[model samples]
Target: MIKIFRITAKNKILILGSNGQLGSHLSNDLAKLGEVTSLDRNGFNFENPESLDLIIKRLSPKFIINAAAFTNVDGAEDFEKIAYQVNALTVKKLAILAHENNAVLIHFSTDYVFDGLKEEPYLENDIARPISVYGNSKLEGENYINEICSKYLILRTSGVISKNEDNFISKIINLSNDRDELNIVSDQQSSLNFSGFISQAVLEILTELESNIDKEKRWGIYHLSGQEPGTWYEFAKFTQEISKKINPDSNFSKIDINPIPSTQFIQKAKRPKYSFLSSVKLKEDFGIELPNWKKSIIEVMENNE
Candidate 1:
């Protein structure tokens, strides 16, 4: 036995991109259960390759979870090189460093790795054929982690709605305060994963990893995300409807929601027509079940209040 509980006390964990929405929540959640050191743009810049290797060798954390990514979908189209540098190259470096230190690397990826043409939910083994630069870069990053890191866990999710300082949720909440109606895309379908929910999943992984520290073969990629799938428009309506309950006087519920196809919604980067991911594998292996979209919505709404 690896003395799982003991490792929790002795192990050092580092979280990259601690400033973003998902990162912020994950940092807070992980800190409660173990020793956690978080780095954001202020401390670590993915663009600067020099800092990455230095930090990894210096910290030698037992667990390294990278929440950092060039998330600007449209911006990625214009800054393809930067996207590759930050998304793919940095992850590769991190994986290499983690392997060298005998640490376990846990990375977050996106459902955008798929082309969205698939009629059903995407499985972990599905062939990744990205239609956009961001998606391709994310897929590349996943590959790097898989190839370089001896022990690793790559979680793929989509429609990540978090309460961090910056995210789609905060943006929607802000805009809802200003406008009565919001236009959201209904054609694209994907599951929504809240930051809080993801934090719980990470905790579970750490708990399991501590117990099986010696079981290196147990390490592999998994799908950690929400269960119920919905379109951007459907999610918006659910969000707005929930907001009205919190702010009864607010007219978010009254907002006119129009379901528009992906073609109608013009964007600099192309999104998968349907990138919904299935949580079957995660549930089977980890005994973890994803929360429903409505349940996640209520949780975020309540947290905001």
Candidate 2:
């Protein structure tokens, strides 16, 4: 059953990491519901934890959506401490603040929390076994949120792609501009989520919360992603195909995609072989079905063009 929830105009909402790919979209969507106070990296520095208390105390927002994180997969390998500080320790502090203020904390988590040993898509209840420093740091953050925050929603997503930022899809598009041939990993498998779609889905949940429709059932982790699972190579090819149709004069039309094994690619951090998330729980609970990856890809490309 699909439920439409109404949000009051005066409710205050604070969004951290407002300049990020997902954060940017979320800020725009969330602004419609209530008063939105957005904070970029400069506004809320994770490195300086002491300053957070003053910001949270002063804002006194009813909801705090944290989209900030140290998301450099390869870079995390070289700087585990910085990753842990930003991803784990800072999340703990935020969780504490949210708890003290009786604010709902909506934190974004990654699919990398899983080890990718399972053939099937991961469920919200699946045991997390992270394989890299980046994954471990994210898992630690999740643990902190679970421990400290009673009113929280941990949304686990995978391969977040956006037209406005540097992600998997944008990287491929940029690379195609300069190179005729592109090599992408075929072994990695996950669902690619669009920032716009994700933000809309989140908006639905927030609306429900405002209406007090599903207040009791909303707190906890949920898997949100595109409908189908696909490999990196397949995603790149689809992007290329769509890009060619959208912009025939673009260099993406001339690019030849080459599939390569994960082992062939060298990187500082290890990625999960299969980390696709199942959005069945999210659909059943929120009554929102995520769009297909192809639809999202096409929409993003069309909007950017």
Model 2, which residues run further than 4 Å from truth? 1-8, 213-215
**What are the per-residue Cα lDDT tens digits for candidate 2 across 1-305?**
11112345677788888888888888889888888888888787887788889988987988999998999999999999999999999999999999999889999999999999997989999999999999999999999999998889999998888887589887887887778689999999998888899999999998888788235657899998987999999888888887788788878877789999999989988888999999999898889888988887877787884
Candidates in order, TM-scores: namely: 0.92, 0.95
- Candidate 2 residue pairs that clash: none
The top-ranked prediction according to lDDT is: 2
- Local distance difference test scores for all models: 0.81, 0.87
| lDDT of candidate 1 over 96-125, digit per residue (tens) | 888988888889999889998887988999
* TM-score attained by model 2: 0.95
Candidate 1 Cα misplacement greater than 4 A, ranges? 1-8, 176-180
Evaluate residue 91 in candidate 2 and report its C-alpha lDDT on the 0 to 100 scale: 94
